[model samples]
Target chain A: MNDVIKLLTSHRSVRKFEARELPEGLLETLIKAGQAAATSSHIQAYSVIRVKNPSSLEKLVELTGGQPYVASCSEFLVFCADMKRPLEAAARTGEDVVSGMTEQLLVATVDVSLMAQNVVIAAESEGLGICYIGGIRNNPQAVSELLELPKHVYPVFGMCIGYPAHEPDIKPRLPVDAVLKVDSYRDDETQVAAFDSTMHAYYQSRKGGNKDANWSQNLTPLFNQKLRPHMRDFLIEKGFTMK
Target chain B: MNDVIKLLTSHRSVRKFEARELPEGLLETLIKAGQAAATSSHIQAYSVIRVKNPSSLEKLVELTGGQPYVASCSEFLVFCADMKRPLEAAARTGEDVVSGMTEQLLVATVDVSLMAQNVVIAAESEGLGICYIGGIRNNPQAVSELLELPKHVYPVFGMCIGYPAHEPDIKPRLPVDAVLKVDSYRDDETQVAAFDSTMHAYYQSRKGGNKDANWSQNLTPLFNQKLRPHMRDFLIEKGFTMK
Candidate 1:
């Protein structure tokens, strides 16, 4: 396989990073790449906090569901879905700033995700390995407090990036036919059940796989019970209206 | 600047691509990288369609707000926020699929965005240039018919990727101070205005020192009135109950 193809096909999350500091302008360059991503309406409703302070990193690591990866990485960043700057822009220019709604929240959230991926890509190209800490959402209040995040700007996720100390095996994915459709959407139970077996095998190959190999079983708890339960309310409290 | 950093920082939308075919396994690698992105509830609620047929490309270009760029690139993909898979999964197994609503739509949309960004990054790392075609949303219904997309699966955007034929300057972004904040989200008018000026200068420079320069003037119409006016309706039509 081509080198780039190999890199993409076999990407693994890096949990350990070298303690060495990153080279200069790396953060700026990453942010630039992120900002270059396509935004809905060019709103660019996102921001990144470059957390280089070790004490702050410690606090963040704790807040991020006690994930040690947050502290171990040389560079940590929190991507924020920000609407405050645009609101401020409208305020100064005496323009209407009415998008404090749920729709706006969704747009900003999507926008931040797009930008954050760009950051990940840029970091990877620089020979850096990064892991996303979705655990950051486990305690959103604390994250907001630590980051001094104001209303209409919420932490979407945390990313830890640095030179890799250890390389993990590439995680397997559902087959192309399982996810890719030519025209319209189609679903076959047999295909999913078959894919479930494949996923189970993938898990068995790893020392620590999901508790249950069944994709549905693993997914039930995530959506049926937890995840984004109060995100809308949280956004509302933070200054977004779900209108 | 490092080669990787240069790639990240200097990325520009390349509407024109070399007719050269992608290397073997590259497409699969790109799709895998996309799948590895974080999915809400691990539902992986998205699908990608790789268009190789010229007639299909022409049809898409016509449907995508008549953007010639969509037809010009070597690889064209329409990213879909797909809920049909899990919905069907539940139906086949007689499980309740209760959450395929507005919130679910948000999850799928964000999920697809992150995945698409991963593909972009992966492609760029392999010396590919990409342009996101948001105009696909302009006439979602027509595009849907052309692509034979089904209910509950809507195309979020179209992406064209391949080798570049032009080297455009990196677009400027709002200042970090204006966008980034600590701990609570803060809105600062003066900072935003200054950044807007920076944007104006960047645009002016791009326009070869043209007279008009304010960023707001260039963007306000799109967000305030056009492009997004009926997107909510489009979502509803896709069988997403935005409750």
Candidate 2:
């Protein structure tokens, strides 16, 4: 494989960091690389907030369900899906802007995600380890208020970037046959069953091995309960009414 | 910049492609690279459908707002946000799975976008070009029916990948100061106005210099109309009730 493809395939999330800040200009270079991702209709509907304050970082750690990496990492960034700029920009052209269509939410969310993925890849290429803190959404309102986000913008997720303090094995993904299909959707129950065994073995043989859970059991918490049920109302209050 | 960072920042969407097929195994390698992206709780809630049949390609071209490259590209992939697999796996463990919630929708959508971005980067690194066809959402119902997608699964976007038939200039993004913030949200009117001038010059000097528009003006159509108003109801029918 080529260097880029190799880097792409070797990704593993790093939650433990060495507490060393990045070089002065590297973060800006990474953000510029992020801006190069293709956006929907050229609507660059995303903004990233870099959190360097110790008190704010501590609050964010509590807000994100006690992910200490949020505070311990060299740099913490919250990626927000932002429509405020686009809406105002369009309004300047003398158009009666439609604000809360569901498609707007989808477009902005996807735009920010594509941009953030580019940032992740760029950071990894630079030898910085990173972790995506989806827990930011567990308390979206507090995160929004904390970042002083305006209307038509919401925090999608947060990312922690720094030098790695731990080396976790790359988690194996689902078999290629399970995710890829020809022309139509198909069930991959057999592949999934086989993968359960692989994951079970992985959990038992990793660096610290006292776990006895398979993939299916690991997914129980996410499915058995309503997750972030307030997201709909929060998004609506933030101007993505899903009309 | 290093080679990877240089590649990341030099991306351009290529709509015209040479009428040639990918080598036998390259597509799978690209998908493997895509699978390396991090997932929320390792849910891996996504799938990809590769459409090669001419009839299906024609139908997709129409479904995606007549993007002829859908049929002309060597490979056309439909990236799907899929909760069905994870939900079913969790249910098999004897937990009563909550079928749909707003967070589930967000997670699946974000998961698929990250994976697809990895695929895009891998393709570009291999001397291939790609274009993201967001038009797939224009008639999502028809596209889903064409792909026979099940409930709890929805197509997020389509991608056209192949050798480039023509090179296009990389489109400039908004000024960096406009998107990256420090600690708190801030308005970027000054930087945006400066970017307008940069884009205006770019539009005038580009190879085909007949177009006269700035970035703000280009976003008018997306906001002036209720674009894809059916998406909310469509997603609801697909079992993503945004609960």
Candidate 3:
């Protein structure tokens, strides 16, 4: 197997971090790797805010639904899907300001995500561990204020990076047939069933021997509880019409 | 510097591709790497469709606004922001279908992007080149039909992977300070101005010695012409309420 494949295949999320600072210059190098990732039309519509201050980290943890790992991690970065630069550039160049458009927000959001993934992979290759905090979006306005995010820029996600304190098990996925379509999609019930079985076994055996909730049972309430309800008004208030 | 850092830092979009077949098992390995990237709450709401059939590739090129690279590339994969799995899971468990709401869409979109970025990095590490194709989104309906994408799953982007026929120069980025915010968001106008100068030099020296357009000048029309128009209705039709 290729080394990259080996690293990627057995990948697992690590939330527990050792109490250590990063090696010399790793932060700068990782950010550079992030900046090097592709941006939409080279607009580079994103920013990485390094939270080095302890008080600021505590605020970030509070904004991110009190996730202690976010505050306690060795390195915490909040990736922003930033239109502030482009908005400022437009102001400088005397161009029009596009208020409340889904197009711009979508581009910026995806752009930051692209960069964030590179940062994670680069960190992984250096033997650093990573966990993403989607909870950053839980309270976008608070996060924006704490991070001093200007208008047209919003926190898309946060990443906790450090040496791992524990080796989390590799999470199983739906089989390729269920997810990877060849020329067309197959919304096959059997495929999902097979995948649910795989997921159940994974939860049962590897994930601290937890009871295996099949794919449907685990997913239905998730859609009801957290993600589906809160995110719409959040994006709207953050200047995206999502038209 | 590490070889991975070199790959990440030196990445350039390769428009021209050499006529070479990928080694066997390369695509599978790439998909595995993509699947391993973090998903929101482990929902893993995304999929990729490999477009190997020539007729399908040709059609996809047309749908992608005549980006001929779509047809010419040795391997083309479409990254999709999929909510279909959760919906089907909901049906099996007697949960609501409207549950795949805006937040769910956002999660899947971010998840798909993270995976795509990993695939790009892994592909480059293995001596291949890739260019992400946001144009695949130009005609979502046609793409859905051609790829047989299901409801609640939209095409987020396409990717072309192959050996490079041309070695392009590394594109310059905004200066470190321009994009990297500290504990708080701060914009230094002087830094932005200086970075624009650096970018002008990068473009001038690399591409035939012509005077390069400043960053603001380059982006003015991009935000005007093609990108700002399409997303709202497209996303709506693809089943996101954008609530």
Candidate 4:
């Protein structure tokens, strides 16, 4: 296999990082490479905020429920799905632009995601370790205020990039049959049951303290509890009114 | 630059493809690479449907408003944001899982986007061209019925993969400063104005037929008129109620 394929296949979300910053201009180069990702109709509805202030970083750490890596990483970026750019551009041309729609939100979210994944691949290629911080959504409104995000912009997720302080094992995934269907969607209960056991073994064997839970058991809280239910209202307030 | 960086930065969406099928096992390998992507809470909430039948392909082409490449590509797969697997797994364990929430929708959408982009990177490494057809959202319901997608599973987007018959120039993006901010959000009016001219030149001189529109002007239709406003109600009908 080629180097790119190997790098793509062997991705692990590194949570620990060495206290080393990237080389000069490396982050800029990475972002430019990220812009190379495919955008729907070239709308490119995404923006990334580099969190540099110590106070803001500390606040975010607490806000993300004490994820210390948010502050410890050499570089932390909050990726935001932004429709304001297009709205402003259209408005400048005297077009009465629609600011909020479900399709617009989906497009912006997909756009940010495609760009962030590209950034992750590029970072991994440079011997850098990276992790995606979805916890940013755990407190989206506060994050929006902290990052000074304007209307039509919402922080989708945060990313940590730095030198790896530890080499975490690549976590196993659902078997290929479970995810990649031939022509139609089929139930994969058998595969899911098998994967639960595989994940159980992985948790017990990994370097981190043994977690006595399988994949299904681990997902109980996320499914049982109302997970960040305020997201709909939050998105509406941020100008993704879904009109 | 390394090969990975070069491959990523040189990405161009190829809508024209040669009539050649991928080698057996390459698509599977690519999907495996995609599964390696980090998922939220180990919930790999996604499914991929490979459309091979000529009749289904023809229907998808018409549904996506005559994207001819959708039919001519060597392989076409629809990346689905799926919550059915997780909910079923939780249900089997006798947990009363929450059926629909805004957070679930975001997680599944982000999960599929991450996986599909990895598949794209893997395909590119193997010298295949890929295009993401967001136009599938234009007729999501019809596409879903054609693919036999059950509730809690919706096609997020369709992807076309094959060898490029003709190389297309890499599309230029907004200036990095416009998207990447330090510490906080910043207004990018000047950047947007400058990029409009850049895009104007690109459209007038590109390999495709000359178009008389700038980037802002091009976005007028999407913002001025409601583009695919039916998505919200449709998502609700498809079990992503976002309640």
Candidate 5:
């Protein structure tokens, strides 16, 4: 396989990082590569905030529910789905533009995601390790306040990038039968059951430490408890009114 | 620079494709590579439907506002943000799982976008061209019914991947200053103004033909009208009640 495919398939979320910082100008080049990813009609409905201040980094580490990688990584960035820029640009053109809509929220969200994935691939190509911090949503309000993010903008996720301190085994995934369906959706009971067995073995044999949970067993907490109930109200207040 | 970075920076959306099928097993390998991308909390809230039927391809071509590439490409796939699978799996394990919440919608949307971007990068690495069809949301209901998509499963976008018949110029993007900020958010008026001039020249001298418009000018119609207003009600009906 080519380097690109090989780099992609052997990917793992890197949490531990060496103390060394990224080489000069690498972060700039990585962000440029991210801008090359496709945007919806060139709207570029996204913005990234690089947290370089040590105090702000510590605050973010706390905001993300104690993910220390936020403080230790060579660089940490919060990717925000930003419709404000395009809306303001369109308004400057003297068109009667609206502020927020449900579709606008979706477009900005997807646009940011596509751009961020390119950033991930570019970082990986440069021999860097990365971890996505979805736990940012655990305290989106506090992070938003700390970042001074304005209206019509919301932080979707965060990323920690640095040189790897350790190489962890790539986690097992659901079989293709469970994800890639042909022509129509099908029940995945068989595929899901089989994957649980695979994951059960993976947890026990993984490098970090042994855990006794499988796929479905691990998902119990996420589903049983309310998962971040404040998100809807937070999005509305941020001008994602979902009209 | 490595081949991966070069390939990524030079990516262009190929509308015209050579009428040849992919090498055997290439598609499966590409999907596997896509699966390796990071998912939020292992929710893996996404599904891909391979659209091979000629009539459905033609219909999708029409559905995407006469984007003929949908019909002409060697392969077409619809990437859906699916919460149904995981929710059902959690339910079968005797957990009282809630179906539709605002956070659920956002997670699924981000999940599917990340997975689909990997698919795009994988396809491009193997010398294929790809275009994402956001117009699928224009008439999402009809398309969803045709694909037999159930509740909590909605198509985010469609992709056409194949060998390029023509290599178009890589369209210019907004400057990095406009997209990336440090410590806090900043207004991008200056960068946007500069980018508008850049896009003006790009539109006037492009390969296909000269067009009289810039970036902000082009966004007028999108913001001036209630773009995709039907999406709000459709998502609600499809079990993405962003409550």
Candidate 6:
């Protein structure tokens, strides 16, 4: 495989980071790389909030479910799905802009995710570690207030980027056959079962066998509980009326 | 910039493609690279349907609003936001799975987009050209039926990958300052105005000055028109209630 593909496959989320800071202007460079990602219809409907204030970072650490890396990382950015700029720009053209459509939400969300993934890749290429903090969603309104996010702009997720202090084992993924279908959707029960065994072994052998749960069991908490049930009303309140 | 950063920043959507097939096993390698992207809580809530049949490709061309490249590209893939596998697996573990949370939708959509971006980067690194077909969302239900996608699975977007027949100029993006804020959100009207001028020059000079619209004017149709208003109901019908 090529170096790019090799780098892509070798990814693992890093939680522990070195105390050192990023080189000058590297964060901006990475964000510029992120802006290079394709946006739907050229509507660059996303924003990144870089938190450098130690107090704000500490506040974000609490807001993001106590993830210490939120404060510890050399750079913490909250990627926001923003329709405000585009809608305002279009409204300036006297085109009665539609503000809160479901497609608009989807487009902005996809745009930000694509952009953030590019930033992650660029950071990894620079030998920096990065982790996406979905925990930011646990308290979206608080995080929004902390960032002063305006209407039509919601934080999709936060990211922590810094030099790596620990190299975690890469988690195994589902078999390619399970996720990749030919021409049509196909049931992947067999593949999932096989992957369960694989994950069982992975969890059993990794880092002195500290964990015993398989992939499915690990997902149990996510599905069994009403996880983040507030997201719908929260998004709607933020002007993403899914109607 | 490093080669990887250069590659990430040089991305442009390639529509017209050479009539050539990809090297054997390369598509899977690209997809494997895609799976390496970080998933929320390791849910891996996504799947890819590789559409190879000529008839199906032609149908997708019609479904995606006369995008002939859907049929012309060497490979077409429908990236789906999938919760079926995870929910089913979790249910098998004797948990009453709660599906259709808005957070689930966000997670799966983000997962697929991140995964697809990785595939795009990997493909580009191998000198292959690619385009993201967001038009697939234009007729999600029809496309889903065509691909036999079941409940708890929805097509988020499609992608076309092939050798490039023509090189398109990389579209300019919003100023990094416009999108990146420090510590808090900030107004970007000045930056947006500057970028509008930048885009005006870009449109006036690129490819023999074929286009005249600036970035703001370009987004008017997308914002003024009720673009893809049916997506909300369609996704709801597909069991993504976004509740």
- Residue A145 of model 3: what lDDT? 84
Candidate 2 positional error at A192, Å: 0.7
Worst lDDT run of 10 residues, candidate 4 chain B, spans B87-96
Q: Candidate 6 lDDT (Cα, whole model)?
A: 0.94
The sequence of per-residue lDDT tens digits that candidate 4 reaches over residues A177-211 is: 99988777788889998999999999999987788
Model 4 score (lDDT): 0.92
Model 3, range B1-243, lDDT digits (tens) per residue? 787777789888877898888999888778878888898888888888888899999988888888898888889999998887877786688765565467777788899998888888789888899998988867877888888886688888899999998888888887777777779898867877887788787777885366758887787776544463667787777777666
Kindly provide the TM-score of model 2 when superposed on the true structure, using C-alpha atoms: 0.99
- Name the 10 consecutive residues with the lowest summed lDDT in model 1 chain A: A220-229
In model 3, what are the clashing residue pairs, if there are any? none
Which TM-score values does chain B get in all models? 0.91, 0.99, 0.93, 0.98, 0.98, 0.98
Q: Looking at model 4 chain A, report the run of 10 residues with the lowest lDDT sum.
A: A180-189
Could you tell me the interface RMSD of model 3?
2.1
* lDDT at position A207, candidate 3: 50
Model 4 lDDT tens row, B21-119: 999999999999888887998899999999999989999999999999999999999999999999888777787889779889999999999999999
Q: Each prediction's DockQ?
A: 0.36, 0.91, 0.64, 0.85, 0.79, 0.91
Give native contacts recovered, as a fraction, per prediction.
Answer: 0.31, 0.89, 0.64, 0.82, 0.71, 0.90
Expressed as tens digits, the lDDT of each residue in A1-243 for candidate 1 is 345444445556788999877898677777777777777666788877777667888888788768887888878888888877665554445444566554566678778988887777677877889887776776777788877888877777788899999877666566777776654456655668887787677777775444445665555554443355555556667786555
Model 2 bad stretches (over 4 Å): none
DockQ of 4: 0.85
Model 2 DockQ reads 0.91
TM-scores of the models, in the order given: 0.84, 0.99, 0.95, 0.99, 0.98, 0.99
Return the TM-score for chain B, candidate 6. Answer: 0.98
Q: Give the whole-model CA lDDT for all candidates, comma-separated.
A: 0.72, 0.94, 0.81, 0.92, 0.90, 0.94
- The CAPRI classification for model 5 reads as medium
What is the clash count of model 5? 0
Please give the lDDT score at residue B235 for candidate 3. 75
True contacts kept of 2: 0.89
